[model samples]
Target: MGNLTNAVTIVTSASSGIGAATAKRLAASGARIVLAARNEDKLKGLVSDITEAGGTATHRVTDVTDPDDLKALVGLAEETYGPVDILVNNAGLMLFSKWEDTAVGDWDRMIDTNLRGYLHAIAAVLPSMLERKSGRILNMSSVAGIHVGDGAGVYGATKFFIRGITESLRQEVGVGSGIQVSMVSPGVIDTGWADKVSDAEGRKAANELNKGAIPPEDIADAVAYALDQPTSITVNDVVIHPTN
Candidate 1:
């Protein structure tokens, strides 16, 4: 295990849920955190809390779906702290819907946020990391990607896409670039995502499944464990779920 002392960490989707939890956890480890999300108020409050607790942190209002915003986020992090040492790609959408419902809009939202968002953040940070030849990228995924549940067709597919990219990125950069790529796939973590489902039946099913959901902090712990390792070791994928 290694400490996160002075690590410059950028956590996207950091206004709430897993992203927020991960930011706080990493900051506690002495990492300089840069929080990014579309919500300026939440990001400001989070940064305040971290600094008040004797940690270094800043906030950047960013929309992950926009590549320029992601690039600006990276730039902000570098100016505020230093070059990014860790990137936590946590911005995502999980819109549950049945295949027969033809929830095309939900599908597009998920693809843009879950898939494109991740890629955009990666592109924004990877060049700097590559130049340094040392950095970590942790992608947050879901169990639905591995074992799809009812009414999560498009949402699960997007996660599946994350899984694929995580692996591909790891293969492409992990061996030669000294860049660690990892994935944290959580099962039924209640981030209030169930209540956000737009489809009626899908929302019902999601709420029911969320009954067994774990807290976002659990996944944050997993993220810390994965990142707080010696550069020689890569945690790869951590699949965390409730023991029911």
Candidate 2:
């Protein structure tokens, strides 16, 4: 295992849940952090906590769905710190709906945020990492991506896409350069995962699914583990779930 000292890490959707927890975990390791999310106020709050704890941190109001916004976020990180050593794509929206209900709008939101948003962050950072010849890209997937469950069809699809693409990306970028890629797959977590379930039945089911949910910090630890691995060893996929 390695350490995170002095690495410039950019975490998207950093306002809450896995994103927020991961930012704190990485920051505690002495990594300089850039927190990005749509809620500027919340981002600042987290930044304050990190700084007060003696970790270097900054915030940016970023919507991962916007490619330009992601570009600007990376730009800010570069402008603040020299070059980004780690990029964490943690922004995702979960609005579960049964296919029979055909909630087109919810479907679009999942695709745009969970899938396309991941792509946007990767696109924003891959070039700079390539140029630097060293970096880490950590994509957040979920247990739902590993196994499809009822009432979460499209959401599962997006996670699956993340799992596949992250592995493929690891192969492509981690060849000779010091660059590395990894995926963190977590099961039901208590914070804000089911808040957007619009369909009544789907919403109820989604809530129940989180009954044995683990804390978001658990997943954050998993992300830190991936980043802590020596560059000679690539921590590709990590799956963490409540055993219940």
Best by lDDT: 1
**Residue range 47-96, candidate 1, lDDT tens digits:** 99999999899988999999999999999888888899999999988887
Worst 10 residues of 1 by lDDT: 1-10
Q: Which ten residues in a row have the lowest lDDT in candidate 2?
A: 189-198
Reference-based lDDT, each prediction: 0.92, 0.89
Model 1 CA lDDT for position 23: 93
Best by TM-score: 1
Q: How many clashes does the backbone of model 2 have?
A: 0
Model 1 clash tally, residue pairs: 0
User: Any residue pairs clashing in model 1, and if so which?
Assistant: none
In model 1, what is the error at residue 41, expressed in angstroms?
A: 0.9
